[model samples]
Target: MHVEWRGRIVVDPELHHGEPCIRRTRIPVSVIISSLADGISEEELLEQYPKLTREDIRAALAYGAELLQPKSI
Candidate 1:
């Protein structure tokens, strides 16, 4: 079962042990976020992960932001 998150991110129990990853790829969202936080440029990321697009990177960021938001009771 594959569940879409933030459009480009996906969570599939069959993939990466259900860690949220970029849709259609095994690259986890956390890897993307951490790479960027470590000062890896967007262009470099694209080069490193040929399957990823700028929009996909944005989606990862959006997904992370969404996860950080407080939930109302």
Candidate 2:
């Protein structure tokens, strides 16, 4: 089974140990976020992950931001 998040991100147990990744690619969201945090520019990221787009990067960021939000219980 395949699960999609933020349109461009996906989570599949068969892939990357179910870590959220870019749809159709095994690149995990955490890697993308970490790369950006480590001073890797968007251009560099694009070069490194050709399958990803600006929209995909933005979606990953949005996903990360949502995860950081406090849940209302």
Candidate 3:
């Protein structure tokens, strides 16, 4: 499925010691991804963390994919 992944994902040595986060929020994308990896469903995620949205989750995935992507030399 086509997903809209925005630039909300951010990483900086000054922020969270360089861990990937959801830009404005200190919530790490890795945390969200890990939760899902541990079998946390989308609906459960939203319900558990009312502060997160579907888009946020998608952005995290996109950010992770970008990190793993091999850069063209």
Candidate 4:
């Protein structure tokens, strides 16, 4: 299944060298994803990045998952 990433997730040349990131912040989506991979819970994520919401993290993960999918020929 493919998830449509919208809102907080955005890609901008000025942000993280064009890496996907939270729309208004310099934080890269990879940082969020890696934290989750390392067993950081949503609450911990929120605690670390006070401005980040659960939805933002979910969107980042969905975007990452979409990137990992095989492209159809």
Candidate 5:
């Protein structure tokens, strides 16, 4: 599952106070991650956020995973 999260996620200081969000949408990556963590299904997510796609959901997962990687000095 090699998802290109960079293209799906965006950080704009003018949007959501600079929170990382799905491109062209105000929904934060954290919200999507949290919803999934809380047992929300992909289909359910799509219904909840009609603006999001399956790829966007996957991208959110990928982005979150990338953040957990150990940073090098």
Candidate 6:
């Protein structure tokens, strides 16, 4: 199955064992979230992962937030 989160994040069985990742990049969304949780700044993230942009970081956050929302019956 193919899953797209916030249009910028995607999950494909062929990549990272199907983990959600930024589109066109191998960087996993969980990695971004974890890094931020560990106190990494957005600028630092950009510097560390040059392939990522500010919008990509925001998309990761938005995707994570969407997952945390309650599911309706």
Per-residue lDDT tens digits for candidate 5, residues 1-73, read 5779999999999999999999999999999999999999999999999999999999999999999999999
State which candidate has the highest TM-score. 5
List residue ranges in candidate 5 displaced over 4 A.
Answer: none
- lDDT per residue for candidate 6 within 1-73, as digits (tens), equals 3233568999999999999999999999999999999999999999999999988998898889888989999
Clashes of 5: 0
Best lDDT among the predictions, by candidate number = 5
Across 1-73, the per-residue lDDT of candidate 1 in tens digits comes to 3233567888999999999999989999999999999999999999999999988898898888878989989
Q: What is the lDDT of candidate 3?
A: 0.83
Sort every candidate by lDDT, greatest first.
Answer: 5, 6, 1, 2, 4, 3
Q: How many backbone clashes does every candidate have? A: 0, 0, 0, 0, 0, 0
How far does residue 35 in candidate 1 sit from its true spot (Å)? Answer: 0.1
Off by over 4 Å in 2: 1-5
Give all TM-scores, in the order shown.
0.91, 0.90, 0.78, 0.87, 0.94, 0.91
**Every candidate's lDDT:** 0.90, 0.88, 0.83, 0.85, 0.96, 0.91
lDDT preference between candidates 3 and 5, better one: 5
The Cα error of candidate 3 at residue 65, in Å, is 1.0
Instruction: Give per-model CA RMSD.
Output: 4.8, 4.9, 2.0, 1.8, 0.9, 4.7
lDDT of 4 by residue, 1-73 (tens): 5456787788888778899898777778999999989998989989988888777888899989888989999
Evaluated at residue 40, the lDDT of candidate 5 is 94
> lDDT (0-100) at residue 31 of candidate 4?
95
Backbone clashes in model 2, listed as residue pairs: none
